[model samples]
Target: MNESELIARYFAPLAGPAGLGLIDDAACLIPPPGCDLVLTADALVAGRHFFAEDPPDAIAAKTLGVNLSDLAAKGAEPLGYLLSLALPPDWTERFLDEFSRGLGEAAAAAGVALLGGDTVATSGPLTLSITALGAVPHGAMIRRSGARAGDLIYVTGTIGDAALGLSLRRREIAGGALPAWAKTLDAAELIDRYLRPRPRLALTPALRACARAAMDVSDGLIGDVRALMRASGVAAQLDLARLPLSAPARAALAADPALLESVVTGGDDYEIVCAVAPERAALFEQLADAAGVAVTRIGAAAAQESVLGPDGAARRFARDRFSHV
Candidate 1:
């Protein structure tokens, strides 16, 4: 099918009232009273972001999910998004079917709709970009520069699973050599995390109410935390032992303890990391708990410009995260 037919058949149904049924050249948005619009964009490229052979649905989900993650960190409610999909010349209709299905499912789950988008044929790899729009109460959007000294640093959900999953998918780690406990590790689960990251939208309200500063962990916890600290002009002391890990990740680490660096430094986690005031930490935790999302306090802001380890000593790594350049 051509671009117009492709969108009319697969994407039109996913548009919201503001989307103009995917027919208009532009979309409309009207923020609620006493609210400000929040905007974020993310792009995914084949082979670089995901395997060229990864499922179309997963690619669709990741393309939008990463953008949603940004809104979540800013404590904003998702409204809609604009997509720019670049399809290779040889892509099949079946691929479009599955890709649009995945995008629709993810958009529905997040309560977001497609506002408008452009579709084009490309000579290189399949490339997808999305600009997501959300809203928060005026002056209430969380920021990466609002953290203060003595504020507690917290992260939602576990870290590093997606990075590990990428290693497995790339055959960097031999599946046959995995330990017994790690052998039973659900490969699908790990791969799913890598492909379809969960944006912490459910925690937005708590973040808006209690977080001093916030940003989603897209490029490894360590690097992203360091960026947050730099943005806030503060230092941090993180207890490596307190870094939350999933059962599969724990088993993988037990078999190869050296993977710790990759766990903390590899990217694509898509979880929220925020700083909360000491007095408000309790209420933040309570609200997060009520939302049924796990939140862990792993560190606190400091006056210096370094990141310290569990040993209370400054630490440095070869590389803190993935760099596009």
Candidate 2:
């Protein structure tokens, strides 16, 4: 039998409140009175999410971060999580130690305890899965379907830094010329961002109030926002000039104008994309200020079924940001 089938037969039935019923990433759990349960899971496989040579600690951290990002999108506070892990038989002890360190650091950052998990040997490749559970107030969970046509769209942190970071790492591995953004950044920073991204749980409480809709930017900014628009039955218009580009991203764009496409369409940015009402702009600004986070108003929603750019014309995205198929 295949691995998936074996898991279904033996592992799935064994899951309960003590174990998730294999319905989703992590377990759909319960919390105290007035609390809402939130669950999310993510998996990373060698040759898929990371290169074999990538640091194990970074890999473990990223696996957790991706799951945490999903919980943040729902405006949930990190409660605890389960780790289902497998490592190749040949993986080094040093690698495992670093990997555990990274994972431990990320969990602590979210204020979550590592409740329980399973570890196994694997001949295929190093793989890690994290199922994060969180709690929010009853009826307070943010979703992707509440945006109105006139709502304004905002993104937290910056838009394109992580994508640009990935490009720099790939160039270095291929022995190609470094991108200008790479030149300005410490090489380690770029590589680490590509691997160990920070989850936006801190922004969730603020967003729970102002945001009409929200989603984490696992896919590219454009594609993720598009999902929000689709869910809310609205169209969006973005002022290209308003995108939150990092200083290094601007430098890269100045050096090689063609790289703008990557900045827009590349995925794996863990920032939050959310919509707020036009009147709530000031309130959002205040909330973000109190939280010491910046929320950029990049665009607004329109009834028309298109996204317009700076010149007030529709811009066609070059590619779909993330797709399982």
The deviation in Å at residue 80 for candidate 1 is 0.2
Q: How many angstroms is residue 27 displaced in model 1 relative to the true structure, after the best TM-score fit?
A: 1.1
Judged by whole-model lDDT over C-alpha atoms, candidate 2 comes out at: 0.77
Candidate 1 Cα errors over 4 Å, as ranges: 172-184, 305-315
Residue pair clashes in candidate 2: 16-19, 57-99
Number of the top-ranking candidate, with TM-score as the measure = 1
- Residue pairs clashing in model 1 are none
Candidate 2 lDDT, 60-106, residue by residue in tens: 77888999998988899887788887868786657756776777677
Candidate 1 positional error at 21, Å = 1.1
- Name the runs in model 2 displaced over 4 angstroms: 1-30, 184-188, 308-313
